[model samples]
Target chain A: MNSAISVRHLTKDFRIGIRGLKLRAVDDLSLEIPRGQVYGLLGPNGCGKSTTLKVVLGLVSATAGEISILGEPSATSAARRRTGFLPEAPYFHKFLTGRELVRYCAQLSGVAASDLDAAVEDALGLAAMKEAAGRPIGTYSKGMLQRIGFAQAVVHDPELIILDEPTAGVDPVGSASIGRMIHAMRDKGKTVVLCSHLLGQVEQVCDRVAIMDRGKLVLEGAVEDVLSRRDRHVMTIEAMTPAARTAAEAALEAHGAKITSVTHPRRSLEDLFRELVTGSRDA
Target chain B: MKDSLRRTLWISRVTFLEAVRQRFFAFLLVLSAAMVLSSVSLRVFDFGHGELKFIADFGFGGMFFFGSVLAVVMTAQLFFSEIDNKTALTLLAKPLSRPEFLLGKFFGAWAVLGVFVLVLASLQGVVLWAREQELIAAAEQAGRIPTTFSIVGLCQLVLLQWLRLGVVIAIVLAISSLARTFLFTVVVGSLAVVAGQLQWIAQDAFLRPTDSPAYAAFLWISTRLIPNLQQFNLADALVLGSSAVEEGALIAVCLSGLAYLVAYLTLGSLIFRQREI
Candidate 1:
């Protein structure tokens, strides 16, 4: 149970055209995602990340290998009962209000009648969707849709939540909103597996990350362990004159260290955008 | 088991809402209603049949034709809309099984068809009753017997037509589970409807002496597999009293429709279980 999701030697092949030419979507992929952490699955458009998620959620069958969720077989209802998934570019029935859609998903996910109202309200509140919950889903913006999608995914209060490209087409504010939701899930000791192409958000939200390419796992490790370079250091100093800079460089050289590069530290564009646009357009 | 059924019901509820909201369902319904209403003006061209029989035939024709179209096109659209819109991805990822999802679609589409049949039958019943009243008045003046439509028989016909549409929906769903595109499913589903309507011919041939075992086997399978949709077209006998239909015969037709409906739904469920969402 320490591993939230265990995928062993997973491979998926799809047939194409009339001849049924085999296309390998996942190539011998194996992963052991731990519990109570935010894990990011990163890859390009066709790198099998979504396919792997689909297999783990049992939406698609694996051509080979075994996958289990919380010590139960992935395809079993018992396993799925404890799992929630929000798919990429999510679409819901347009006629339903956001609240109705969330409530509908809650019922399908087996929320008891006694707790259904509370659970739906809690999830909608967490996604910041309570304001627009009464409106039809067709009226939702991209950000609102993602938020409501997030609400539906968590309404069941599952132990493990899988989100595939949760913020793919959303703005920075919406993306940040989803990030906070993921952090909140982790804080609640729930395992959250995120699949995304936004590396910056992934870096900010995920504790561990696995990168795939050409249907193979290329890298997997703790984000801090893989990203941080122990051999180099960076420091930001304010109001440094040329003389002070030369003096600092000489001091570092005398200590057997060299100033490899000198540059000013700047904020990321996403951070800048979020700061300039303080309020969400959807709000 | 209760939870599974509850989940299935939820899916069906949403699906029913979605199908009803479609413009296509509304369009076919309006068109069918117009046909049923217009049967009065068109009664003169009944080819020498009684006025009530002509009106009954007209209404039944509208129901049979438009109901089949709605069942075929709407069921396929209902199923494919989910897949194409990727809503199925969100739904199938839950604890729901493929059979539950398929059955939900079936029930939802069937519910819409039920509404269609009910509306047309009610309107047809009104028209038939009104025409019968006028005919009875004229015949009483001339000392001649007048024809009247049977209320009980109309209700029975409504149920029969609803069951027939249910079978069509089930057949379309099974085809959709195997077919890749909506157009493909509709084409094949329409063909299946046509086959079912003509299945009595296959039964007739099967009962007669056959030449080859292979042909006989084909006929046997066709007769068993394709339901005789014509048997449900007893509007003349049941509604207009052109002939009397035995109670046992009506029950047999109903049982046959139910059997086909179940068989097709089971086949669809099994096929959908293996489908890659």
Candidate 2:
């Protein structure tokens, strides 16, 4: 299959003032987001990461370049029909119940009438929002809001899903829930592109990542390839007595090797929090 | 085509629901209703005009003023709220087109104005009906014919006013598409309404022969560009039957209103298509 999204020589310039001064938002960027994997696009603030995503989604016009989604030219309704987007800091109508909002999006996304109910319910179920789906969105907490936003984005069953900072301002528990959602999308053969500031979460969930700086790509590779140190290694030894440790060190020294450091493997705080607070949901 | 229309309808459905729930809509509805109801008490200062005529004039004036304000301010507020709140980010990122979004907003705000006009017109009808009965009784005792208002004409006036306000909403939406702030849209929209209300002056100037081609060209553009809002102000002819208006004239007014409505909405859609949401 073709890549989920393709961009070539994409550049976007925004005119700043009456004098027509130009500000370059995206400069000669090219990317090929592969299919059926979770891809993270990471950068600091104003690095043009969000602008690149918006250009791919056709929300903002590119001054020069070509973008295609799923083999179709981008910025067309036909191209967008098979794609879903969850924006950064999502805001929904306060008056609408979660279910209503999802249903509204499904219809707008061209969900067939016969399958609309099933699609909406399935989306809500996946986001774990089915229980609070009938309440007004104003009543939802920050985490619930993000979950509902996720539900709306996927309700149409788009083949490509792009989430921009889906977990911003969300607690770790909510963040974990979103990570699971991303995994679910990947399992279903959907292309998931995540733009996020949380490097740890992105490191955990993304199969591959691209880091940008100053409107240019600095690094792009598989997570393991980019992060692994080939010259060094780590080994975990359990239940080692003092005599056994001395013997291992002597064995290594005889083979012309030495241990630089020794320490126990420590679990991350996120893992510890999840373990201690098992079954505690944002609800 | 069918699916696009469906999307537009879904968007307008939410927009209309959001707009009607606003306290501003309810507040204006109450104020306009109060004006209609209070017209009965205020008839003493009619300055020697006919009783029913004064009442009709009072009600029509209330509808015109409040309906225009509601159209200009409410439409801008609805459009700007979606943009400033970043709700447009979510909605526009979907498969929905920019034109569809702008058209949805137009229809939604127009529907709210429809309710405003309907409620006030109904009140005006009731007040006129009550006074007509009393005047008929007194006139019968005095052996003189009683002057009464036409309910059918009042209904016609309601329809015309709704169309007029629809045009105003479309114009405001066009402005809001290019505007960055709510206050800007309102100020420009209010100014447009004032220009449209006085457009008849340019129309008259265009009719007279002019020596200067520059001035004639100015008048020509002015008359054609700004809709003749005065054409729809047929309260006397339509409601009170002060004079007989030709059928062709009424149809011409309706057609003019619809044309401007379509033209302005098209302009808004084109401008909004280029706008970066």
Question: Which candidate achieves the best TM-score against the true structure?
Answer: 1
Fnat per predicted structure, each in turn: 0.91, 0.85
Native contacts retained by candidate 1: 0.91
Off by over 4 Å in 2: A241-243
Best prediction by lDDT: 1
Q: What TM-score does candidate 1 reach? A: 0.99
Residue A189 of model 2 has an lDDT of: 96
- Give Cα-based local distance difference scores for all models: 0.93, 0.92
Q: What lDDT is reached at residue A167 by model 2?
A: 97
Candidate 2 TM-score, true structure as reference? 0.98
Candidate 2 lDDT, tens digit per residue, B1-277? 8988888888888889998999988988898889889999999989899989898888889899999998998899899989998899888888899999998998888888888999999999999999999999999999999998888899999999999999999999999989999999999999999999999999999999999999999999999889989899998998889999898989999999999999999999999988887
Interface RMSD of candidate number 1: 0.7
